[model samples]
Target: MANKTAPDSPPGSAGGTPTRRRSERSRRAILDASLALVGEVGYDKLTIEGIASRAGVGKQTIYRWWPSKAAVLLDAFTADVDEYSAQGLPDTGDLAADLKLVLRATADEFNDPAFQAPYRALAVAGANDAELSRAFVDRLLEPGIRVYVDRLRAAQEAGEVAADVDTRVAAEMLLSPFSQRWLMRTGELTYDYVDTLVDLVLRGLRPGS
Candidate 1:
């Protein structure tokens, strides 16, 4: 009788399940190593070899999944951000107060010592690398912005925000100043500063204003 086997199965295995499980483990290890290494050595010194060594995988393994260390770092950062943003923005039925809470929390994260180096490295590198910049905006920044947009839309439905207000633009107006101040170092990022921004933005967006 002829031997029976599946064409796609790995040699000496029943199926590809073990291979897929191993691949997922390697992927998680690579992402974690990238995040840890970026924090330890900063982005300038981070390399595929370093990530491969820390991850206990071949450099080819990382190359197979990501083109460069920047791509790896971006993926790692996106994973981290996604974990935090899984809950979306807060909506407490008071638009101004909720905005203040969220913005102040964001300010705190931006000012965090542990968060500064890796974030600044990505931001600075993205400034010069157009492809990475676009990826950063598309994969990381825009999703977070959409959360803010969702909260604003909720507010609009509740009569806290004007029905005519464009949530996307309004979200940007609410967030852009805080981001600029943090990224440019042009102004202090403080809770009071974010509160003022929230106030000014809400003043313009309020119904019948």
Candidate 2:
């Protein structure tokens, strides 16, 4: 058979361009490195140089995608939360049960040692950095909050929640207490605590409470 050269492939036709694949790998490495380093060194001690070194990428590469170490950590944290939020709040037709289930899961996540270090670091960093604070609220916090809002809206339509209830406020009410407790270390984030929050919030949102 005669030797022949194959035609050039399009950017995303089969396996994507080598540059695109390499960029994605670099992005994943950067995000993973940021998370791991934050957990290991704490965010105060974390730097773009540290992330670049850990990711095996140039500092310029990280700067090309994120403005600061806080921004990198924000992206990393958002990526981790995206995996869980993708499933959203459960809708078992019983709003109280679903709220308790999700809240308890949240308590468990907050209680986990591996999750605590990086999460607390992110929380503290967001408090000091205005841009990072906005990004964290916009990217990570609001989306997670919306999951609750959505579930509540579903309950409203199902006649489980009162029609007059403000789902957004109700969602915040359900979440803010646990968040305060978890972030401030004011109290234990136990399943019982979250279940109580669920019951209390549900009682207020019910038709005749």
Model 2 scores a TM of: 0.84
What lDDT score goes with residue 204 in model 2? 93
Best by TM-score: 2
Taking all chains together, each candidate's TM-score versus the true structure is: 0.81, 0.84
Off by over 4 Å in 1: 1-26, 39-42, 84-86
lDDT of 1 by residue, 50-81 (tens): 99999998887787778789878888888766
Residue runs of model 2 more than 4 Å from their true location after superposition: 1-19, 83-86
For each candidate, the alpha-carbon lDDT, in order, equals 0.82, 0.81
The deviation in Å at residue 157 for candidate 2 is 0.5
